[model samples]
Target: MPESLNRELLEVSAQVRGLLQDLQNLGFDEVPLAPPTAGLPRCGTAGRADGGEPGVSCRPESLEEIRADLENSPCCDLCRERGNLVFGVGDPHARLVLIGEAPGREEDETGEPFVGEAGRLLDRILSAMGLSREEVYLCNVLKCRPPGNRDPRPEEVAACRPFLERQLAAIAPEVIVTLGKCAAQALLQETTAVGELRGHWHEYRSIPVMPTYHPAYLLRNPASKREVWEDMKGVMKRLRGGGSR
Candidate 1:
C-alpha cells in the first residue's frame, strides 16, 4: 500500500469523525446511512444495516429555499424591529464563507450583512487577500439585527441557529471565517474571547473555522487589524491547500 493512499484514508477518516461530532453537537444523534445494493460494490459509509427505519437520501438545499423559509417564518422578535431578514448574500457555491455576529443599523436598513462601515473594511480585507465579496459567501449568526446594534441574546441565537446550520450545509465551504466573538462563540460553542480564538484552526461540522475580530472591533481598535490579517493569511493558506493555523 502506498503511503500517499494511507494518508488520504486517514484524512477522510478524520473528516468523517469531525462530521459525526458536529452532527451530535447539533442534536442529531442518529444519522441514517444509505442503503446498500444487493450485489454492487460500495465505498465509505455508504450502507446501513438491513432493518429499522428506511434510509432517506438527503440532498444539499439551496440558499433560496432557506431564505424563503426565513422570510416567511418569524424566528424571533428581532423581526418586529427589523426592516428585513437579511438572509445572506454572495456566491452560493463559494469555497469560503464569512460569518458575522449580526446585522447593525446600516445592515438593517440595507437588507444585507456587512454593508456598512464594517462591511467596507471587510471588503478591504478581502481585497488584501486578493479576493472579492463575490468570491466568497457572507452571512451572520443572527439574520435579523437586534435593536440599537446590541449583541444577540441567547434565545435569539438559538432561534436562528437552524437557519445558520442549513446555510452552512448548503454552502459546505472548505473554510469558514467567523468575524467577532458572537459569531465565534455561536459556532464553536466556546466561551473564550475572540482574542484567544483567533490565530488557531477550529472545526465546525468538518469545515475549518477561523474566528477573528469583527470589523466593527477593528474600527474601534485599529491595532487589532494586524491580528485579523494574520488570521486571514492562515485562511488563504488553507484555501491554497497549504494548511496553516
Candidate 2:
C-alpha cells in the first residue's frame, strides 16, 4: 500500500476505535460502524480524561475538600457578602448540568442562577428537551453579577473557578451544557468563537461539555433558535439513549 493511504487508514482506524470506546463508556451495547460526519461531534469522554488543565489546576479529592476550599477561599467578595451564595440548584445526581456566564440583574436580586427572564426562557427550553428545573443542575461561571451585565473579566473568572470546580465535584454530572460564549470559554479555557464551538461536544475538567446559545442571546437573535433547538435535540437523544461515541 502507498504510504499516504496507509496513514489515512491508520487515522480512520483510530477514530473508529475511539468511537467504540466512547460508546462503551456511555453504557451502549453497540455504536454505528461509521462516524456521524455531520451536524454534531460524537459524544465521548473529554480529551483530557485526567480532569486537570494544562496550566490551570483542580484539587477535588473529597466533598470535604471541596467544602473547605469554598469556605477558606477569598475568591469573590460578591459571593461572600451577597444575600445568598446561589452556588447551584438541582438534583445532585442530575445527568445534565447547565452553566451560564454569570448572574444577571434579576438573578442578582434573587441570588439564584437562571431566575431572570433568560432563566424563564431557559426553563422552557429545558422542558422542550424533556428536562425540568428539578432534573438538571443550574449554575454559572461566576456566582455573582458583573457590573451593568457586562462580560465577566478574566480575573473574576479565576476568582470563581474554585467554587465552580467544587460544585462540579459535588454534583458529578454526566454532561455539562455551557449557555454562552463566556461560560463556554471559561469552562474550556479557550477564546474560540461560539459559532465555531457550538454543535460539538468539548470537554472540561473531564466532563462532556456542550456549547449552546444562551437564552438571553436567543431572546435577541430568534433566528438562531433553530440551531439551538438542533443542539437541544442532540442532548435529548443522548439523555434518552444513554449516549453514542
Candidate 3:
C-alpha cells in the first residue's frame, strides 16, 4: 500500500476507536456498524428523525402541562395546610432561572415565589443585572411553604423533587442562580455552606449553576450584598457568552 494511504487508514481507525470508547463510557454495550438511515432528518432540517411530521417538536411535556398535572398534588403535609401551591412564575422560556429555598408567608398568600421582603431585594439585584422578574424564571426547591417559614423537611423535599426536576427540564434554562444554602444544596446535592459555594460555578443536570446568598440573608447582613453582586456579575457574564470569571 502507498505510505499516504496507510497513514490515512491509521487516522480513520484511531477516530473510530475514540468514538467506540465514548459510546462505551456512555453505557452503550453495542453499536450498529450501519445504523438505519431511513427517516433520519438531515442536520438543520425541519423533518423529525423519528418520522414524525415536520415542525412537530418531540421535546418533553411543557412546564404548563406539568403544572397542570401537579395542580392538585397532595404529596406532602405542607400541601394540605398551604394556602397555595406556589408552583412558580415568570417566562417559561427564560434563559435564566432563579431558585430559592422555599416560599415565605407573602409568597404562600400570593401564590408567587419571591414576592416578600427578600423578593424586593431580589428585585434590586435583578435591576443591577439589567433584568426584571418577568425576564427570568423563579421557583423554590420546595413548592409549598413550610409551616412558620422553617426549613423544608427531608421528606417534603423528597416528595416535591419530581416537580422541581420536571420544571428544570421543561424550562431548560441556560443558567441557574441558587439564592441560598437550601437551594444550592438541593440542586448540587452537597452540604457545603453558601459562603464556600458562592462565587463559584456548579452544575445541575449539565446546566451551569451559580450559588449566592439568599436575599433574606442579605437583608440581615447588608454587607454581604457586595458578594452577592459579584456572583450576579459572573452570572451576567456567563449569560453574555463570556465564560465564568
Candidate 4:
C-alpha cells in the first residue's frame, strides 16, 4: 500500500479502537446509531489487523449465549489477530439472513459485517424491498480478510465453516440470502453459476437459501444489478408468504 493509504488506514483503525473502547466504558446511551453515509462503506472504520484490544473469552451454554460468546470470545485466529471479529449483525430473530462470501477491508476493520461499498448498495437494495440492516442478519463465509483481497482458498473456507454453521443454527432464520457464487456454492455445496443457482430456492439443512449476485460484483458489472433485483424480489416474495419468484 502507498504511504498515504497506509497512514489513512492506520488513522481509521485508531478511531475504531477508540470508539469501541468508549462503547465499552460508557454505554449505549452515550452513542446512537446514525444514518449511513451515501456511497460510503456502511461498516464504520477499520482497525489493526493484529487485534487492537484484548477481548474476553467464555463459553456460552445456549444459542443466545453462543451469540454473545462469539461476540466476546477472541479464540478464533481472526479475532485474536484482528482487533475485531467480523460477526454477523441484525435482529437475532430476523426472518432473513444475508450471507456473503467473506469480510472485506471495511468489515475486517470495524468488526462488522456488510459495511463496505457493496454493503452500502446492499442496504439500498434491501430498503427498496422494505427492509433494513436491522431487519435481517448479515454475515460471511469467512470472518477474516484473505491476503490481497483474493478469493478465499478452500482451506480457509473449510476452517470457517463450523463458525458459520453455528451462526446459522443459532439464528434459525426463515430465509437466507446468499450473495455471490462463492457463498451460494459453499452453503449449497454445489458448483453452478450464480445465474443458475438463483431464481429459485434451495434447502440448507431445511432452511431456505436464495443465491444472488454479490454487491461487489454488481459494482464492477452494473448490468448484473438487474439480475440481483430479480433475485431479491424472490426473497421478498417469500418473506411476504408468497411463493419464491
Mark the regions of model 2 whose C-alpha exceeds 4 Å error after superposition: 1-72, 80-83, 242-245
Best by lDDT: 1
Best by TM-score: 1
Residue-level lDDT tens digits of model 3 in 18-73: 99999999999998786555454431112242344667445455677667767755
Model 3's C-alpha root-mean-square deviation from the true structure amounts to: 14.3
For each candidate in turn, the TM-score is 0.78, 0.69, 0.76, 0.70
Model 4 global lDDT (CA atoms, 0 to 1): 0.77
Winner on lDDT (2 vs 3): 3
TM-score, cand. 4: 0.70
For residues 43-136, write the lDDT of model 1, one tens digit per residue.
1122222221235433445688788878888888997779877888899999999999999888888899999988999999999999999999
Q: Can you list the residue pairs that collide in candidate 2?
A: none
Off by over 4 Å in 4: 1-64, 67-80
Whole-model alpha-carbon lDDT for candidate 2: 0.77
lDDT of 4 by residue, 34-95 (tens): 75434431111121111323342222223455556566764445555554567678887789
Q: Where in model 1 is the C-alpha error above 4 Å?
A: 1-54
Of the pair 1 and 3, which is ahead by TM-score? 1
Model 1 worst lDDT run, 10 consecutive residues: 41-50
